[model samples]
Target: MRGIVLNATLAAVKFAGGVFGNTYALIADGAESLIDILSSLLVWAGFRVAARPPDANHPFGHGKAEPLAALAVAVFIFAIAGWIAWSAIREILTPHQGPHWATLPLLAGVVAVKLWFSRRMTRASEEAGSTGLQVEALHHYSDAITSAAAFVGIGIAVWGGPGYETADDWAALLACAVILFNGVLMFNRALADVMDTAVSPEFESEVRTVALGVPGVAALDKCRVRKSGLSHLVDIQVRVDGELSVRAGHDIAHAVKDALLASAPHAISDVSVHIEPIK
Candidate 1:
């Protein structure tokens, strides 16, 4: 919600400031900020859907929505980058006065706000266990960087004599490259989520430790994991004495499920346990 409001305000500010002050960089950044509002809304909608309980159609819940939202954000970024590059190239070829001195403070404020937003996104990503939020954090950081570049471009044009008029255009071009690079990296991560990427070794080790802690279990045959929204779906196979009856093995499997769901820090939404008898 905060991000929505802030992005909208900054978008309007940068767009108006860009036109009034003749700074191509500020205009580009502002345009990107406007699309950021749409991205934020998409993320909000995705999370609302993801929070829904599992249904017949989506037995694993709607966790994939977050990744899809991230993909949309990446596409938006790519579009913004392309537009900025084109706009900047035109401004450079035609030539124009840089941003106004009056707009410097405003641009600085935008950078500060974006840096704060970047930090906030980082915390939110960690708490929610969301790769989407991680991508957003990076996006916000890029905004700060670009905004700073705009500020410098304007400052140099104002005081560094007449030939520096093209500085703002150059800054916009650089920002475009940075935005595209960030977008590509995020695209890959979101695609991985869509593919149901596996969990880390440390998490798998934790699952094994918990499962092996069971008294009747002789060994842990295997453990696997995959992301499901903010949680993971885990699979475990446990070995036990061959003499144990089928009923006993079944009980052990149930025990393993209960233990994992209760103890896992990553919030195991579903767990499948296979009992293997040791010969």
Candidate 2:
């Protein structure tokens, strides 16, 4: 919500500054900010859907929505990158006057604002362990990168005068490459999550250790952990004495599940335990 509002306001301010101040780089930055508003809206909707509980139609819940949203964001970034690149190239080829001196301060302020928002989103992403939020943070950082580039490019144009008018356009072109690179990274990450990639070795090890600590569990035969949005789903096989009664084995399985859930309430959303005979 905050992101949407901020992006919209910045987009308007940047567009106005770019048009009146005669900086194509500022215009490109504004276009990126406009895209950010759309991306934030998509992320917001995805999160809402992802938070929905499981239903008869969907047994695994709606967690996939989060990654789907991230994927959409990546697509938007690619489109915007292409648009900015085309615009920058056209501006570079055309002869134009240097940007107004006032636009330099505007670019500087934009860089500061984007950096602040990037930090805030980074903290939120870490705490929530959300792919969508992480993408949002990257968007802010990318915006800051573009804004900083524009600041320097405009400074060079205004300082050197006349022949340097194309410097800001070159900077905008560079920003497009950076945006496209980030888009690829975000797409790959989101696709991995959608494909149900295995959790990290260290995280799986932690889960295995917790399961082993439960009483009656002799050893673990297998432990598989996969991420679903902000949480993890675990499947594990634990070896037990063959002599133990069926009821005892069931109890042990339940105990293991309980311990894992208790250890990381926010992380582990569900667990399935398979009890195996030691023979």
Candidate 3:
């Protein structure tokens, strides 16, 4: 919620500054920030749905909705980038007088705020295990860099003395490129999550170590893991001693689950263990 509010405020400021200053780069940057606001809102909405208890229709809970929201954000980013690029091309073809000199200070302020927001949100998202929030943080970080580029362009346009106004168009063009690149990156990441990619190797290794450590477990046969939003849904198969009783196998499985939960509290959402007698 805090993230959402911050993004919304930044978006409004950028939009207003961009329009009044008659700076294409600033306007593009502002548009990207607006996209961030939408992304943050989508993330918050997804989390809200995810928190709902499992019902008859969605036995697995609504966690997957978070990734879907991320996908939507990616699409929105792509559309915004496309629009910005089109406008930039038009401006370049029909050269225009530069933006207001005052926009430089405003852009600098925006850059600073974006940098701080990115760092803080990144840490918070990582700790909370919210991949969506992390992606949004990255977006803000990228915005800062692009906005800085715009600042340089604006500086050149106003003070370069001769033929520097061309720099303004170049800067807007560069900003458009950055926005497109970010949109592609976001799309790829969100698509991977929607496809249920395997969890990180570090996470898999931790799960294996815990499962193998369970008493009476002879060895690990298989471990399959998938992400559901910020959490992992693990399916593991372990080989236990053939002589072990049913109760012993159950206890061992429970131990493995508990150990995994303790080891990676933020990552492990649920664990399902299959016990097979050692051959």
For all predicted structures, in order, the TM-scores are: 0.96, 0.98, 0.91
Return the clash pairs for model 2, or none.
none
**How many steric overlaps are in each model, in order?**
0, 0, 0
TM-score of 2: 0.98
**Which segments of model 3 are wrong by more than 4 Å?**
none
- Where is model 1 more than 4 Å wrong at Cα? none
Q: Give each model's whole-structure lDDT.
A: 0.85, 0.91, 0.79
Candidate 1: lDDT over CA atoms? Answer: 0.85
lDDT of 2 by residue, 1-279 (tens): 999999999999999999999998998899899999999999999889988888999787788899999999999999988998999999998999899999988888888999999999989988988889889888888899989888888999999997999899988889888988888888888888899988889999999999999989999999999888888889999999999999999999999999999999988888999999986
The Cα error of candidate 3 at residue 251, in Å, is: 2.8
Q: Of models 1 and 2, which has the larger lDDT?
A: 2
Error of 1 at 176 (Å): 1.8
Q: Output the TM-score of candidate 3.
A: 0.91
Pick the lDDT winner: 2
